[model samples]
Target: MSRIHSTHDDESIGSDSFLDVVSNIVGILIILVMVAGSRAKSYVREPGEAKSNIATAMDAEAAKADLRATRRTAQSLAGELDMLTREASTLANEVKAAEYARIQLGTFVATTEHELKKQRDELDDKTKRQHDLAARMVAARRKLDDLQREQISVVSTAAPEIVVKSYPSPISATVFTTEVHYRLLNKRLARVPFEELKDLLLDERRQLVWKLEDLPEVSGSVGPRDGFRLDYHFVRTVRGGSLTAAYYIPVESNLGEPFAEALAEGSQFRRAIERLDRQNTTITVWTYPDSFDEFRQLRKELYRLGFSVAGRPLDKDSRIGFSPGGSKSAAQ
Candidate 1:
């Protein structure tokens, strides 16, 4: 019984030792499998890291190309800006020069205008002086012509005599055998125009009078008995190596009846004569200073008509149809 108990205890001890050994072997196998799995994961991570590094290098190259293009554009823009700045400076200088030229032209025009005005004033003064000198020269020429006429008259051998007479004297008994009337306008004795005298000479056929020198009575109501009768003798004379005509006119007629009828009703002379008696009434004419030449011509006609005429002289400035105290002559 002792032997059997000891053997059983030995068998139990052997079995426990064998179980410990098997557990140790299984732990070692598990450690080996974990180490292999960790190594394989490390290999896969190495390939991905290499691909990421290549992509980074390509991106750096692209960024370099873009920077170069940006730099070139900036340089070109700077050059264009410099050229525009220079053109702006040149235009500014040209504008300043044009302004200076305009100022100079304005100054020159002002000076020219002043000179032209001065010349115009001088011309007007000269023209006025010239006109005054011309007027003086004309007056001198007229005086010289009068002197020549006087000299010619003094040297003439067959010239008519100059007769001077006074007026407003008593009329002779035989003077009122015939009478005539005439007029003065605005208190001025207006002369007969030379053209009217020339027309009268032409109408009377003065050439026929030249042939009638041998006849005793060359004029007496030959044709129409008008207001006048002309008896003229034309004399030929050689003066200054030229043949000249010298004529003498004599008016011989009684123009009383016709002249009285021809006088207008409203005339001053007609009105005056109507208030006077017909017999032995003396007629007096008021003469103006301007009528000296006309009076001389009219005196001959009155003398031919067998009428004695008297004159009272008045000033040239005297007003006609005016009385004292500002009254009208007709109203008075």
Candidate 2:
């Protein structure tokens, strides 16, 4: 029993030693497995980190490029805004200048209108004054004429006896020489520029001769020389023979000085008479009914001055005229 028990103990010690060897082998195998796993994990992590770094660097570069582009865009927008602001300011200044010019032009036009109105008013006032003076002169002349008429009527009614007077002078004869004409009307006396008007009519006849070809007669007017105008009628007749003739008439208006003023020294009538040669010029008086007394006085004065006088009695409405068939003046 002791021997069997000792054998069992020895088998058990052998089994125990085998078990310890198996445990040591298993622990070494586990340690080696853990080290290999750690090395493999480190290798995989290194590759993943490299990839992440590369992606991050690319993203940062893109971001910086976008920032630079954004800055450039902002700067461009700012420059455009500044340019627009300057243009707007320039337009505003131009508008202000145009408005000022319009205001100035309006003011100048108003001033010119005011000056024109003032000048018109002054001209109107002067015209009114001149008309008033002319009216007064006409009134005074009418009154004087009436007074003279009254005086002559009274003298004629008071003495109806005829007084005969004789003067030594040459016998009456037809006037065929140079003649000086005088007009007596409205108690006024004036020289008739008959010769000058006739000469002017002759000059106009030269120009009017061509008109006779189209018409049998032509009428024309000459000057207003010395306040008298000559209206003439020219006739062209082919009866029996071709004949051209002109009939001229003197038209008178406010053409004479008042008798009192005309008889004064250095008067227009006096100066005209002084310039005439009495020896060669026969004085012809055209007398109107209203101025018969004045004409008689003028005739006596002309006779006293050694000038032969011829009297032509004309009605109030008659115009002094000359014709080819008219009678010559008989002067004494």
Candidate 3:
């Protein structure tokens, strides 16, 4: 029994040992397989990690580039805004200057127009008064001529009646050569205030005396026995009732009856009247047509009333006073 038991123990021990060896071998093989698999997995994981790193780098680079472009665009926009502000300021200044100039010009035009209107009114008023004075002068002159022709005997007979020694017609001084000239001097010079014109006519008396003696008749109505000579003048009435006088003549006789007096005195008186008629025309004015026309019309009336005229009635180039005359019948 001991021997069988001992054998059994040995066998058991041996079998156990053999099973341990096989187990060891299998464990080794398993360890080796696990290492290989782990190596393969590591390789695949390393490649994927490299790819992810590359993608992250590319994305970062694109973001940096976009940031740089945005910064540049912001700078460009700021520059454009500055330029626009400067242009707007310049335009604003120009508009202000133009507005100021327009206001100044408008004021000047208004002032000038006002002055023009005032001047026109003054001119019209002056012209009307001048026309009336001329008319009175023409009437007085006509009466003087009539007196001389109708009253030759009275002038001759009266000793100190201021008889004209001789007077000529077609004269620059017209009628009233010597004695008549003196009488007129007493009458007109007393009332006349224009000393310059009065003096000039009176001073030219020597020339008038010479002209009287030189003419064909050259006699006075009431004085020395030479036949009466005639001087010519043009006379007319104007629109403002003024008289106009000139020194040209285009006369024609319309008388059908013979003269009442064949005496030298009568002839002189008649000749003096002829001269008076001719001298009543020539007049002039420097104004508008309305004013000038008024002067012209009055002169025409004087001529029709036996006032003589020689030249053109009135000129558009003349100046006459705007004041009222001394005569009661004068235009005011």
Candidate 4:
């Protein structure tokens, strides 16, 4: 029995050792599989890391190129900005110059206007002075004319001495009596221009008294006119002797004569009257001092010299002898 049991136990021990060997093989196979899975995972991770590194290098190159381009553009922009600044400064200088010129021009214009105004005022004053001087000259001329008229008052606007009468036969008196006639006159604003005439002018048809019968008779009338005509006839009369009678007014004046000649003319007149010369009408001009006593002296001298006409009588018994025979002789 012991031998049989030993052989059986040997068999069992072989079997147990075989089983233990199988278990150890299975554990080794599990460990190898896990190691293989971990190796494969590491291989995949290494490939991803190499690819990532390559992509990062390419990105760095592109960034460097972009930075260079940005720097170039910045330099160009900075240069353009400097040019703009220079132009702006130049324009500012021009504006300042223009403003200064405008100020000077305004000042000149204002000063010129002021000078023109002053000149105008002076011109106006001169013109006014000239006008006033002209007016004064005109007034002075008018005054001189008036004085001249007063000196020759009797020569102009003289009343006519026309005789209206009838002869023995009234029809004969209708004929004209005088031949030579003249008129001198002028227009006046205030008083009659009695002194405006300078010289006596005769009509064309009546130059000589002998032309009486042939003289034309003036019939028309005008204002303030003195005119005359004449007629002559040769007829028989009953009277054996002829009588001469004439009427006239004689006035003498030294108004227009020079002072030196006036005295000589007065002396000649006195001599002629003393000798009873051929003149029928006579008047003496008396010169006296400009005083009241001179008027009396002139009257006394006139009476002493047989001349008796005065503007007014200053003494009694004074008389004027105009005609040799007439009412004048009777009154004296």
Candidate 5:
């Protein structure tokens, strides 16, 4: 019996050992499962990190390209600014040159005007001096002429016989049957009508006649006459109830027409001479001082027509009348 009970206890111990081995195998399987879960979580996180890194690299390359483009634009703007600065400098120089030229022109004009004024002043002074010299020369010549005239009178008195022979003879008018009268007033010459002269001469109240010799040489005198005598008379009256003397200027005859017009028609004072006998005709010219040159021309014309010419010169204020003697009279 004892031997059999001991065999049973040994078999029970062998079963307990087999049970412990099985429990150890199950704990080892649980540890392997926990390790596998940790590995899976690590793999998911690693893939996400790799994608973020790739995006960062692309953004860096794009920023570098933008920086290069901005630098190129800045360089272009600097070159344009240099060109504008050069143009501004050239414009400033041109303005300065124009200002200098304007100043020079103004100075030159002022100097020229001053010189012209000086020249004008000098010319005026010279003209005044010349006028003074001319006046002095005229006065000296007049004095010299007076001295010569006085010397001539002394020489003439030394030779009485020669002076007597040189004396003019008394002119006789009996030889001339036809006599014409002329008057000069101002510078105009006119012939006195024959009818008007006859009216004045026939007036008995104004009749005056005198005979004289050696009359003074005066204005309107029949100078140096030896063969003929002159007769003149006129009435005197007040004009407009004033003290001024009334002068009756006779109507001019057609013979006293313009010489130019007469010459153009080939007719002159010859027409009046043809109406009378050539040997008995005489011409008397009453001349003013201003008409001396014109009287010379008339004298030459009368001589060509074979007629004698007598001249009676008058002063500026003389009037036509007869002297108490049988000669032309003049009154102021």
Candidate 6:
């Protein structure tokens, strides 16, 4: 019995030992599993953190690039604005200068207009005075002519017993010889330089030939030589396809010497008469009604000098005129 009990006890001790070894192995496996799980979670968190850091750095770089571009754009705009401002200032200055120039021109024009008006006023005053003087002179001459006529009529009526001495005068005939012209008006005498005026008028007509092509009539005046001017009116007519020109010369009434000066010894009339040949030259007196007595005296003096005398009576308002178809002077 004792030997059998010893064998069973040994077997039970062996089984207990086996159970303890198995428990130890299981605990170790559980510890290993926990460690592996902790290591896996740490690895996953590290990878996610690395990805977030890389994305944040890229976003920061993009923001910096955008900021740099915005700064450059701002700088360019500032430069353009400065240039525009300077141009505006220059334009303003130019406008001011133009305005000043315009004002100066306006002032100058006003001054010129005022000066011209003043000169015109002075000229008008002078012309009015001259017209008044001319009217007075005409009135005095008419009164003198009336008085002389009255005196002649009274003498003729009162002197029936006195026998008047008369010279035998030839009948009047057309003057074909060289004629010297004289103006006997305003009780004054002046030599009419008809030849000199004719020459001057010829020159003027030559110069004005171009104007006659477009104008049917052209009027002009020659120079005032020896205080006498020749005013001429030229007419151009187209008849039967032929162009014909004719001119008329009108004498000015203001050209003559006073009676006292003309009758002087060294007068222009006496000198002109002394230079003329009595045989070839005839004295032509253009007489007005106001100066009939003066004309008679001049005619007697011309007859005494052995010169043929021609008398041309003109009306009060008549102007001495010459034309291509005018009648010749009749001399006695």
Error of 5 at 117 (Å): 36
Global lDDT for candidate 6? 0.71
lDDT of 6 by residue, 202-289 (tens): 7777766677678777776876766677777776655311212232233465566787677678987888789988988888888889
Compute each candidate's TM-score over C-alphas.
0.29, 0.48, 0.26, 0.32, 0.32, 0.46
Please give, for residues 102-150, the per-residue lDDT of candidate 1 as tens digits: 5566677778988999999999999999999999999999999999999
TM-score of structure candidate 6: 0.46
Model 4 segments more than 4 A misplaced: 1-58, 148-154, 157-332
Q: Compared with the true structure, what per-residue lDDT tens digits does model 2 show for residues 1-332?
A: 34444655565566566556555655654565555456455544555575876445554555556555555655665565556556545654654565565556657777888899999999999999999999999999999999999999898886777998664355888998889888888888877778898899877877766777677888768887777778877776553112233333445566789987887789888888888788888989888899998877777777777788988999998877786777888898
Model 3 TM-score, 2 decimals: 0.26
Clashing pairs for model 2 are none
Query: Least lDDT summed over 10 consecutive residues: which range in candidate 4?
Result: 181-190
Summarize candidate 5's per-residue lDDT along 119-149 as a digit string, tens digits: 9999999999999999999999999999999
Per-residue CA lDDT of model 3 for 95-119, tens digit only, reads 4555455556557667887888888
Worst lDDT window (10 residues) for model 3? 182-191
Candidate 6 error regions (>4 Å):
1-159, 162-169, 239-255
Which of the two candidates, 2 or 3, achieves a greater TM-score against the reference?
Answer: 2
For each predicted model, how many residue pairs clash, with residues at least 3 apart or on different chains? 0, 0, 49, 0, 9, 0
Ranking by lDDT: 2, 6, 5, 1, 4, 3
Which ranges of candidate 3 are over 4 A from the true structure?
Answer: 1-70, 143-332
| Candidate 6 total steric clashes | 0
Highest TM-score against the true fold, candidate: 2
Stretches of candidate 2 exceeding 4 Å from the true structure: 1-162, 168-170, 239-252
Residue 211 in model 1: lDDT: 45
